[model samples]
Target: MIIGIVKEIKSSEYRVAATPGAVTELVRNGHEVIVEHDAGTGSGFTDEMYEAAGAIVADEAERVWTSVDMIYKVKEIFPEEFKYLREGLIIFTYIHSNAHLDQTKALMESKCISIAYEDISDDKGQWPLLSPMSELAGKGGFLAALHFSQTINGGTGKLLANVCGVETPVITIIGCGNAGLGACELAAAFGNRVNVLDINHDAMMDAKKRLPQNVTFMFSNRENLVECMKTSDVIINCVLWPKTRKDHLIYREDLKLMKKGAMIIDVACDEGGAIETCRSTTHTDPIYFVDGVMHYCVDNIPSAFAQTASATLSNATLPFALAIANKGVKQALKDDKHLRRGLTTFDGKLTLLETAKKLNLPYTSADEIVSTF
Candidate 1:
């Protein structure tokens, strides 16, 4: 199998899908790895590193995109790359199909096979590919709050950390998942009063065991959330909103309930999904004001920490990529039920139920699609 590693073209996206070591692994497994020039530069891996790892370095992205059986990338396919879509090409990346209707259409019309990293599940029903990035995003979201809280950055002028003579800042984190726990860990370390809310009692209890005394676990509900909104200096949303759900966890009007100059860091930057005010900001313009409340909802927060993010993300997705490369996409998906969950599109059909329901498109089960092929 010929695999291509293309540089991420998304705005402010710095992480690469594969690292030099990952390329070496592929090369050792008898798979040809092609990397576009400077593909790993943003992640601190030079072109020479890839070349030394036995990867063919292509001068042009088109060459990499056109020559490969599978294109490995960090982000979803953007408009500029849409023209490169071809039948039988495997797009292995974080295809947020439900969020990008145009991209979904492009993939279906092109009849390419796309496996979404974010949708793939593990044996324990955890998103293995998405977890590493989610953890980074969680920490990055908290770091963003700390920076945005300074008065110089159009913030409320409240310090996130505890001061000698001042009161500790209160941070409210929604959900106790990987992202939320990551946020809570950092926020509590800063000596802030951290409140983690989740609907699952087991999850909350599990988090309570690891967190510090300053962190409190609360049951997520309208009343508790509203109370937290009124008192918390920062609110971090880590809930993975369902794509087909029409309702939002935090409504536009709910922003008014927050204190003036308070901010929201949405780790799960689902546009109109979790927070009504969130509309996927970029690293260039990461913050916006809505009803006196500031919002930081960069969809690719892990990109800010390129080197660490690239290595961790590469490690998480490499095993699955190896499986597909070794056994072929069909046999790999057939053998690993968890990997089949990542199948967003196969042979021009939308195999992801959430995306189909969200976009009003016809749905085909991945199992059914693979059986027919």
Candidate 2:
């Protein structure tokens, strides 16, 4: 199989989907690897590194996209790349089909075999591909809060960490999943009062066992959430909102309950999903003021720490990518139930039920489609 690794073109997105080590592994497996020139430069990888790993370096992204059997990317396909979609090319990436309606249409119309890394699950029901990036995003989100809370950034001048002769600022984190735990670990380590809220008792208990005394576990509910908003200096939302759900966890009216200058770092930057006011921001303009409260909702927070994020993400996705490369797309999907779960589109059909329901389009099961082929 010929696999192509293209440089990320999204604004301020620096993480490349593939690394030199990852390419080396692919080459070792007898798979031809093509990398766009400077694809890994943003992540501190030079073109010579990829060449040393036995990857063919293409001068233009078009050569990598047009000549490869499969495209490995970090983000969803953009409008410019939509023209590259063909009948049989496989796209293995974080194709958030529910969020991008036009991309979904492009995949279906082009009959591409597309797999969404975010939707892939392990036996324990955890998103393996999405977990590494989510963890980084969570930690980065807290860092963003710390930076934005400084007086220079138009914040309240209260540091997130405990200071001598100064009161410790409170930080409330919603959801105790991978992202929330990441945020909690950082926030609590800084000697701040960290409150982690989750409706799942088992999850909260699990977090409590790992976290220090500075962190408090709270049940997520309207009353508790409201109280956190009123008292906490920073609120970090880590909940992965459902694509089909119209309701928001934090409504527009809830902003008034928060302290003035308190910022919200939405690790789960689902537009109009978890937070009513959250629209995907870029690293260029990461913050916006809404009702006197600051919002840090960069869609790709992990991109800010490209080198670490790329390596971790590459490690997570490599096994699955190798599976597809070795066994072919259809055979791999048919063999691995977890991999099949990640299928967004197969042979021009909409295989992701969530995207279909969100868009009110017709749905086809990946299993059903793969079986026929």
lDDT of 2 at 115: 96
Please list the Cα RMSD from the true structure of every candidate, rounded to 1 decimal place: 0.8, 0.8
Q: For residues 242-318, what per-residue lDDT tens digits would candidate 2 score against the true structure?
A: 88889988999999999887889999999988899998899999999888889999999999999999999999999
The reply for model 2, stretches above 4 Å from the true place, is none
lDDT of 1 by residue, 17-97 (tens): 999999999999999999999999999999999999999999999999999999999999999999999999999999999
> What is the Cα root-mean-square deviation between model 2 and the actual structure?
0.8
Q: Residue 72, candidate 2: how far off, in angstroms?
A: 0.8
TM-score of each: 0.99, 0.99
Pairs clashing in candidate 2? Answer: none
Cα shift from native, residue 338, model 2 (Å): 0.7
